[model samples]
Target chain A: MANQDFVGIPSQVDTRALNRGASDFQRLRRGLLFNYLILGAGAILMIVPFIWMISTSFKPQAETVSFPPRLFPINPTISNYIDVFDRANMGRLYWNTTFISVIKTVFNIYTSALLGYIFGKFVFRGRDVIFYILLSTWIIPFEVYLIPLYLMTVQVGLANTYTALIVPEIFTIYAMFMFRQFMYTIPTELIDAARIDGAGEWYIFHRIIIPLSKAALFTLIAFYFMWNWNDFLWPLVVIADQDKYVITVGLATFVGEYWSQYGVIMAGASLAIIPILALFIAVQRFIIEGVVLTGLKG
Target chain B: MIQTIAQKFTGRRSTLRAAEHRFIVIALVPTIIFYAIVKFYPIFFSFFISMHEWSLFGNVSPYVGFDNYALLAKDSLFYKVMWNTMYRTFAGTFLGAFCSLIVALILNPIKRGSILLRLIYFLPVMTSVIASATIWKWMLQTRFGLLNQLLSYVGIQPVAWLQSTTWAMPSIIVMGIWGGIGFTVIIYLAGLKGIPKDYYEAAEIDGASSIQLALKITLPLLKPVVSFVLITGVIGGFSGGFQAIYMMTGGGPLDSTRVLALHIYDYAFQRMFMGQASSMSFVLFAIVLILTLVQFKLQRVDWEL
Candidate 1:
């Protein structure tokens, strides 16, 4: 009787209920097929340029600029990569870029975390107002601040030094906001417990907060590094010395030095991308998740 | 009299609050100094410099005040640059967002190869712009370039992409989308992941078609993400698009690719019109603020998350 009732109910609910189930399965299958097709198509389109870059970088000068371009570097060579270092002082460029990116990343993570801690855990006077003011700074595009920042950098004798780059990048509201969001999810009772256990505020931040927030901190680290690594404008403006130019400017200038040779420039570009691509692969989960939530909230 | 007595007795609690306040202030000192030096000081100083005629060779010639602002409005190049900038921003944002969203939606349903696909889509975002832009510039070469080669296979003539004024800005837009769509796809993929599967199941039970579900449910739920992408798209479009433009065209072929940021870069660095450049920066700032506020207002209607 129970089995009969179930069959009867399904039949009576809608005349084509069973057909609907079949159609649903069909839709799912069609969706799966369509998704894979599009995904494969998208993957090819997105990665072709990168593959082209790598291939062209290894091609000989004539082959690189050849019409009906060769899909592969018919005769692969590392001379272009070698030329970048031998001709362009690629070592100094790498050092300069690494210096700015590393210092900026460290400063941004530390300072932004501390600010996030205060904003998240403390009930200070005008806290909301201060947070709002800080958030508002995100709306002020860097262009608006460039001229004045340049002047100040000149006045303080920090122009052409790495200090001008690292100092100004320290207080990123986007990073601060990310930290605060992560911090908010942490239970306040944990902080109260730390304080009750004779932990100083600094100690709590160091011991309790920093360790627990590694994911968010790592995300910010990756973000700041990428930003500073590829940054051109500020470095172009403030750091005018040939010896001080970062990898970006170096690559740009490299193109000029070997204007006729596309292979060498491509080689340098491929080298420049290696570190970031490696970082992206290693920390992709954190970054993609962080990017999505942060993009939406921001 | 009773209230006064009560307040006096509670003075000790207030004292503790003040102590806590001091600790909080002490903790925030580093951030305060950072903001003052990095953000606020530069902003005010930029305004100050825009009122003066200055140069890179340590000369603050004189305060010309509105003279710089007045001349900027009369400048034909200023209008041309501003219009080009608007075109780039709109075209980049629209095309990037649309393609990324569509591709992301299609890719979202695949249970297999999703991670690898995401990585591939995100590769460009991870790669440095100058590196990729240089490669793209070569590909777009009018003669003997990769794109033209491919176009020839289709029985079409190769067009001068970046050299012609008609094609220059659109060429940038196309490259901008190629470099940019990856980030948007990654972002949209994340947004899609956050959506619960139950909504689709319920929609299915209601006899709602797939397209219907996407429009009626998926889009509305994705509004917050859309608003976010749109705003950042505009912001990034205006500010960071300068890199690719600078590298590829140098605002070339008769200043067809000259954006406002590039304009500021030229005036300040090349021509040494510090006041006019600073004024241009402020104008860009104003446009960003107004556009952002308008978007903020529009998003308030259906506050999707």
Candidate 2:
């Protein structure tokens, strides 16, 4: 049960005004004003923590815990931001997270698209059997496998390594399912036409199919990258080395270490949050639509 | 290439068919192998682990044969944890769903600044749960927290939010709603989009008030989406909250905030009780499976995976 998420405003308001008297129009207008008031207050509630985060990030230690809860700092400082980088190895954390996320997202998307194309576009014996079998794994909670997966990582001697981070998750079920869904949109004529034109099967998938899948690609990339970047439990379990820590894992430990250092902690939180939020906001239209496309409700 | 062509002719397999077969085998073989090793095998292995008194550091894991599951049955703390998990799941899901539905219903008819308003709502959704939890913990701090400070101005006493057992779970549930309402609002918005405008217009022409129209036309039509949200929300709630709970309370003040997911992580990782944790995870799996089955029955669920 899905539809285009952003339909134009429901037209009943206008219709009611046209059908009824001026009193109705006046009432509707007042209702609209009331809606705005409620929405405005809710929006403020929605963003206050973020504003407070940014505000507290800039404040000095004294101001962070000050009486009356200062919304604006009496004295702002960059020292906390500096401390996050210096003590928490925030740069290294960023690099580690970005690198791992990029690798994982690429693996996740590319493999998913390929398999999705195969399962969707190509008909072969046992294809549905294989796909549904794989898809069934989607419902199994990650916790069900967490203990065994960790032990397997240790058994394979991949523990405390980034490969431990990426290898086990190179193929993801959800994205693959989405790509499979996206595959139905791509016409088979394109594949057969390319086949008639003497393009190799792999070449068709790469040059024709993948290029055609940019719509699904961008959305999956944005989401998978964000999810991977923010992944914590696995990295927390596997990567014991601080240098190898992803940003989420790094921030978790950093918060625990500096729990009392309010400004510095907020600075760390701000840095961790700002990158992904900016990335999403920039390409948000696609994601919002992609949510409709994928039925990926968070 | 010549040999392949000859074999294709001899074997009655067309060249394109051969290529397609090759491509599929190339794609599927690895997928099958990967799922078997990583997905299917680990589930079985985890189940196997649950049947024993297992620890990674310990060499000898004497097979306990449902002893771990039995331990959960007898343990008072496990019962407490179960209660907490249900409390969090139902409270968070229902409250979050209700709030988002209201927002979506209101936000649906707006003709101005809708995107900006939606984006503002979605800010917390995009932020990492851990990061959101971090900010939330600060705001909910006992003395210096913003929530307490705000309460002071209203002449209410400063209450311990995350530190008090009574307040901790509610505080967490509220935070969960705040963090998730934007997302659920989007879902409800999409759901609202599905209901045709004709019904509303018809109701309005029949002299039905706005509230009546919502109660009659909109609510009835949106039943499936409401169920979808509730069902998925409950399912996710079973396995969710590890990150937020981990960061904020660490399942503390009195284990009041300890949900199953966090308990599993704590037992498996922190306490080195892997076997017991695995059993708890199976319990979670059973719960999720049952709810998912209900979702499937309630909704068409086609292409929703």
Candidate 3:
């Protein structure tokens, strides 16, 4: 009967140790609550200005400049939206930005994808040499090359044209690197299978590679579109004519024309940001993966 | 007869390899040509132009072989701008990264409302610098600004934020941090998310306090992300600060904000000293390269996470 009996281990008899652990847990939990409240307040502080911008965009000019400012527009009007398109020539700027974005996206994706495909899948002579040069280009800041690029654009009759704006960015090494890393994940057997079926490299890339690489491509598209849309420097340098001005340049002009119209500037910014925001939201899932993947690779 | 047929087929196979090379060339041609014409050729041409004292007028630009660079060495503005750029980069990068990490760490411990916080933090990053600059410009206005209005509440006099030489650069730094914190937060958030919950649980079970847990586990695990942010923060802050200075201040208020970027812009665009600008750019480029290398060296080993 004694042999049949069982008792808890000696460690379990240490009730004071158990009490201390519970007390510590309670303290930590309380501390966490205070931390969370403070953090939330900080977050709200960070967000208020952005909300203010959107709110100001809705209000009338007088209301926008009101003492202490309003959190929400009292009488929100569509006038700023209308003004963005009608008075500010935002429509023209949209076209310019869209044109640049579309061209740059297509060119960047295709060129980078192609170069990445070759570099990733193929083993050819001078591959390492070429890749080394490409890597070297990553560290070379665009500021170093800006004046030269502008001079070259002017020399080549590309100045004052969209070509000048889009052409230089087509050789996006980051995109190439991204695609190369993604392409490495794809099994060689898939390619080999296609090759056995008498498929050419072009057919293989178009039919096989493109279809399989949707996630990365979308990430690239979203990223590049945002970049091209928001770019100020290159467009400022090359696109001299008003007609060639992208949104950033056009917004600068808007400021010059309506220097006092802060509401209108906000309106223009809202308009400019909407498409990129939409794109980011659309590809939100993939973007996180792409970003994390890129970080790890780095 | 079989040997002869095999020989003929081998000749055709060699021809097919040749054709493959041709196809590869064709596929690569457009990118190569565009890259050379658009990117590389311009870089080379800039080097050529850097040798000449070019003017906007029809005056012949005589070759000035390194004279522009030599002039830069003696130019007080050049040294001053370089100094300003370094200062801005150091201050902005370190402070920005530090603030971002703090925000990230604080948010990481809170399970609820983190997503909303992230979006809030990311808004400034998504907004245009020009647009944000305008709003901040209004808020920081000397006489009638909200910041001064708030200062009045604290019994302080209205101070010039952007107009004064003493305050101009600091104003830019304040704006730079405001504009920069969001992306930095996002980067840190992403970094924080990667830390496993088990690490914290283990620390808790071992009777380690929150501060000790953070120091031992979180900070060590987040080093790589920290390093990345630090290096990129420097680069982004330096370049972006220069940009804001150029666009917003025009490097004005006695050129207190005349960082190298604005200096380069003025030389290249306003003064039409393309060669001098190019030399300045190269000098800045060298500085950036050195700074980046130094950062990488300092943090390479610490990038355990």
Candidate 4:
């Protein structure tokens, strides 16, 4: 029954009842065939752009601009990729992005989980008031705070630095709230048992709570990494030096600088997408779970 | 005698409670401080900056109370940007949510390859906006584009998708829907899973067609999910137009696709009009807050039904 819930299909009993007669069975099969045809076609439409992206990345410059553009390159080459790496400082861009993404993801997950553990497990003075204040911050979009944050960064003399990129992104109210929701499901008895064993609060948290909340932790890590990796606007606003640019910022500026270099632009884009696509495939299930938890709860 | 005993026990318990409270404070200190400095402070500062004649390189700017707001009221570009923002928000939200719901309903009945299909659909959401926008820009190119090539087979004229003022916003909307529908479909699928099968069975016994079962049972039950998608979609649509616009069109072809977020970006960063940009940000914030609250209030009424 639980499996049925997850798969979201009719139960065997319902199916058997519906498939009583030969004509009904045939009609059911026909309906399913129709559904598959529509779904398959839609899937093709969804997948084609990505396929086109990869194909374009491999195409020579001439083929990229050829009239009535071909879906597949007539004579594919690695020259575009070579040009992107050689001139675009692709390596530096990757390093800057990876360093920021890793540090930000680690700090964000740890802080959010710590706050969530406290909010979920402890009864402290002004807890509700504090939590609600944190919740209210989620309503204030980044655009509202962007200029002041830039000013604040400048005042602190951190503008155009990695500190500017990483610090402001380390704490998110949504991640904290998500961890709190996950922590609520953990049984209180486990904590009580640890307390009875005379474990310190920090010890209990590190040894017991952290290990038990692995799923939520992984979810947060994957999401935060992707977000920081792909973030453009703040990076664009704050970082002026090309050497410090993240992948998205680098790619965007590259396009602006060389708008007519279609093959090179496609190559850079392909390289930018590969890491995220790999991450998605590796943790695809958890990504879906995270989206369901966040989206449905909204 | 019993009162004294109870008092002794309570006194010891209160000490433990105090210890736990201290622990909570210790655990939460970093998060709270970070939020205070980074999140809370900036919100108040944004409001403060909106009231001043601020610029990029100044220690202080003279107060110009509501002058920026007044300027915005008379600014024609601000109104045009707001209209663009509204157009994208409504059109994107409606199309994305409606298409996702339909896709989810169709996928819910299929047992084979459903997971793979869902993953394929979600590829765009996983992709970086820069890359996706780049691909879209290429595909939407006037003469040498793939979309135009495909349309030619059906005898349709080649359209300058991202080049023309009239077509640019719709092009952005198409990309927005394509990128957004996957996540919404996943949410709707979850909602569909939560619906009890007994309702469908009962409806089928009563000779309810698939369409009737969907309209009467599925749609009503999915109200919460629909409302959730709509509110988030609106918020994302309003605030999240910057990346796509920046990468694909840069508010392009005569600023026809320049949304309010991009407008603020231009004023604050490009033109260095910090005060005016701050004012615009507040206006955008106000609109979003009202829309969100109205959605929640309406959803509450819907739930009561």
Q: List per-prediction Cα lDDT, in the order shown.
A: 0.76, 0.84, 0.71, 0.80
Of candidate 3 chain B, the 10-residue stretch with the lowest lDDT total is B296-305
Error of 2 at A207 (Å): 1.9
Task: Give the DockQ (2 decimals) of all models.
Answer: 0.33, 0.44, 0.20, 0.42
Better of 3 and 4 by DockQ: 4
Residues B52-82 of candidate 2 have per-residue lDDT tens digits of: 9998885999999999999999999999999
User: For residues B109-225, could you state the per-residue lDDT of candidate 4 as single tens digits?
Assistant: 776566788888878877887889988998888777789988988899999988899999999998988887777787787778778879988988899998998899999999988
Better candidate by TM-score, 2 or 3: 2
**Tens digit per residue, CA lDDT, model 1, B194-253:** 677689989989999878988988888887888778877886677657778888899988
Candidate 4 stretches with Cα past 4 Å from truth are A1-30, A285-298, B1-19, B57-60, B300-305
Please give the clash total of every predicted structure, in order. 0, 0, 0, 0
Clashing pairs in 4: none
| Candidate with maximal TM-score | 2
Docking class of 1: acceptable
Candidates arranged by DockQ, highest first: 2, 4, 1, 3
Q: Which stretches of candidate 2 lie over 4 Å from their true place?
A: A1-30, A286-298, B1-13
Q: Per-candidate TM-score, first chain only?
A: 0.85, 0.86, 0.82, 0.86
Residues B1-305 of candidate 3 have per-residue lDDT tens digits of 56544654666556545655665677667766766675567667777777888755566888999998889889998888877887787887788888878887876655444555666676666666666676676667665456786788778988987778888888888778877777777667666766877898888899998789889999999998888877766765555564467556778888888887778778888899887888887776676688778876876633111
